[model samples]
Target chain A: MSDYILHCFAQSGNAYKAALMLELSGADWKPEWVDFFNGATRQEGFREGVNEMGEIPVLVHGDLRLSQSGVILDYLVETLGTFGWETEAERREILRWILFDNHKLTGYTATLRFLRFIAKTGETDVVKWLETRATAAYAILNKHLDGREFVVGNKPTIADLSLCGYLYWPDEIGIDLSPYTNITRWLETLKALPGWQHPYDLMPGHPLPCA
Target chain B: MSDYILHCFAQSGNAYKAALMLELSGADWKPEWVDFFNGATRQEGFREGVNEMGEIPVLVHGDLRLSQSGVILDYLVETLGTFGWETEAERREILRWILFDNHKLTGYTATLRFLRFIAKTGETDVVKWLETRATAAYAILNKHLDGREFVVGNKPTIADLSLCGYLYWPDEIGIDLSPYTNITRWLETLKALPGWQHPYDLMPGHPLPCA
Candidate 1:
């Protein structure tokens, strides 16, 4: 059996966050495909057995099951000793960016992509609203990346793994990445990392029939 | 001088998360109010000086400045040595909930409150959409709070502090907390904690001139 089993679907950037971490860490891991597109996460059994938050990217090891990409990333840092902070200050700095990613970056971009690309909801007030917020978040990140190689430090950390989670799908997100020059450059740096794979290349359930 | 200075405004629950943690930790901290409504955070000077994220709740200690409530709360765990995990597992659990709070709980609920109470944008499609998302987050939190005194571990951790950040203003958010019995009980439990204070009481910018 693999050392880590990730309950995830391909289209989920959140899942990709954990999945990419596992793959890049070179851990013995496997992806247990989840039918998120078919509302698998909404089922009661799944809720009781898996993530209570009804989200995916759950990492299972032996008898322990952990949910949330941030949690899994933090845990892997100890077990894999890769892409982790060396000091408390670095840890907090990494966490600062990760929290920003979850709250603003992925928070807005994910929903916008779901509405525009996956759900196929045409232009609407909600979609526009999400786009505006996502744009603001992108601007902040772009400014932060002005002279930085990674989100936290000179080297790749969980912060880069977290912020760059959904940004890889620029086309699907329907937002021109060219405008955010800094973000695009920073994302390219992440792409240059070893074992880096696009979300579609990383997990299952890609190219949904309806989508 | 206070050991900690929290750049916060009373109207911001995100800021409240850090301020309340400082108060409950009994840290030598003082609130340094920011005029959020007047676009203080959006100003170039403030963005360059305080938080590049263009948000409030930046905690300053000595020469170090920290943004993001999750980061500040985690830092307090080291400085105050209270409500922190004793094990790696516990630490991940706490972080998991904190991420959930940022991504879902506070992510939707904070915007909902800002639209409904602060911006007074009434009954728009965006408002309705946010309400639905916020309500879903509330239900997930309420269900998670079932039979548990705190989020993550049984003891009050940063998870509880982060999730309960904006919940105290249910009336303002126009959500009936009575239906979420577990969340109400949990909020009361937090209110009972020593040094606990309402955001309005703990920080500045309450009772905006128009309100």
Candidate 2:
């Protein structure tokens, strides 16, 4: 029997985070994919699968249910111990970038992605504000990546995975990625990894690359 | 010799989270208090203390320098093995609650506190929006704390620390804690813990809470 079941929408960045970790860890698990576009997350049955707060990337391990992508990643890393980023110092950097993505990047990019693609709302004040936040966020990333290959020191860690999953949506939203050459190069490197899937691939007929 | 030095503003919630873990772990460490009111964090010296990101609480151990509160907390738990919350199951829950606080509670409560006390901007739209967010966050907490004494399970975990640290600030901002009786009760319980320090105690002139 699989040790755990990942409940998430296939294309979600958060879901992909769990998937990435599971694949990296080589853990025995099955993906119980949920249709987030169709409000599967809001369903009462699915709600029961998670905590009272309805959020994605919920990992159900026997009787224990875990929510939040960062938490799930940490859990898999700790339990499975398959990856090199599990070291003490490296783990701190990994977490720093993960929290950074959640605090700074996700706030704006997700908003812009929704407005431009899902919401179909064009050029409104909110959209502009999101765009500005996205721009600032990208600039910060661009500066951080100036001489570095990966986000942290040298090796590919959970930091890279979390960032790659979130940044994968840029092309879909017609946000130019060329300006961030380091990020672009990093994404290419990330895609080369085994079990890598574009965000839209998990969603049927959602127009690959979002644009 | 101490393994690390934690640099933080005396009474910051973020800083306290790191210190609490260190103290609980019995880790050898020294505290370098930064004066936030005097813009110590913005100085080049502090920026160098935390890489280019320039945020705290920053942890320095030998050649390693780490920033971001969540990252620091994880590092302490992973490395020291002193806190019970470091367990696989509890760790994930801890991360979830920390992220929940960062993404949801901190923004709203911080803004509310700033408006009510620090800035006194009287921006009704911002205050109203913050109040709404705070209410939603509190409702989630109240439900989660229905019968449990702590945020995660029965015992006090890092989740409780992260949530309680932020929640304790609401009263300073004139937020009526009376409505969330459960949260208030839980806060009282947490405040009575050993090494618990009121944020105001770190400030120059504010009256310290009678222990």
Candidate 3:
């Protein structure tokens, strides 16, 4: 048994946030491979037995079962002592970006990707609507990254990890990354981190069984 | 001068989260209304100067200017020392819910309300799409509130503040939340708390100039 077990599927960038964190920290963690596409998360048993939130990337460390990538990343920072804030101010700053990532970045980008690639919804009204919002979020982040190497502080923290989770999947998201020069640089910088792996390589169920 | 100044407008439930928190904590805070309805946040100057993320609910306490309601709530927990966790586990638990609130609950609900009530898109395809996603998010939250007085612990915390931000505007969201019995009960319980006030009342710019 690994020290930490992450219930995750490959396509989920949210789960990749945790999976990548565990890997980078060199923690003894393993991916449990959730069958999200098969409607596993939608089932009652998964809801009752696993995360009541009905989501993946549930990290189980001993008796503690935790969901939410932000929580898991923060927990890993403390337990593993890697990619964390040194002071309360930095911690708050890091959290600000993480909240922004969840609310704005991944919030729209992930949905656009899901609709366009995974769900194959095509260029529907919702997909186009999501694209505009996602692009706006990207523009804000690109401007924020103008002179900074990471989201917060000089070192790479979980903020960088969380924000970069879905950016690496731009192909699936069907977005033009050329316009966002700073964000492109930041994503490349994150990719240069030691032990970093693509979401598909880090978890299971990629290319889908149907694919 | 107030101890804390919240850069907010009444219609923004995101800003209201911090406003309500400041109120409940009995912190000396005043709202410096942002003309969000009139393209204030979208302005480049506001984005570059106030918050690069380009959103309101910015909290200013002397030297510090903080954005993101979760960050503000956590900062208040430190400064005010109320509605905060005593243990690491409790703190993580609170953060879990807050993240869920930002990513799921308030994310969809707030957008739905913005499109329906404020934007008044007239039940467009995107509106229907957001409605579906918003309802799913609500269902998950409604179930989580079962048999619980608050989001974390028995007492109210920032998690409740963040989740309840948009839930109070059910009419604007065009969702019949009555079916979510636990959530309805939880809101009632929260309303019974001392210093509880509606977002429209707690912040300025309630009745928009156009409205």
- Which candidate number maximizes DockQ? 1
Residue-level lDDT of model 2, residues B1-211, one tens digit each, is: 6787888764466676777677655778877766665667767776554545655678887877778777777666667864447455666667888887766666457656756666566656546656786787787787778788888767776677667655666655567888888898998887877766665553232432321
Candidate 1 per-residue lDDT over residues B165-191, each given as its tens digit: 999998899889999999999999999
lDDT to native, each model: 0.91, 0.70, 0.91
Query: What residue runs in model 3 are displaced by over 4 Å at the alpha carbon?
Result: none
Score candidate 3 by lDDT.
Answer: 0.91
**If you superpose only chain B onto the true chain B, what TM-score does each candidate give?**
0.98, 0.82, 0.98
**Compared with the true structure, what per-residue lDDT tens digits does model 1 show for residues A145-201?**
999888887899988998889999999999999989999998898888889999898
lDDT by residue for model 2 (A18-57), tens: 7777775677887776667777766777656465666778
What value does DockQ give for candidate 2?
0.46
Label model 3 with its docking quality class.
high
- CA deviation > 4 Å runs, candidate 1: none
Recovery fraction of native interface contacts for candidate 2: 0.59
Task: Assess every candidate by TM-score.
Answer: 0.98, 0.81, 0.98
Each model's RMSD to truth, in Å? Answer: 1.1, 4.5, 1.0
Q: Which 10 consecutive residues of model 1 chain B have the lowest summed lDDT?
A: B82-91
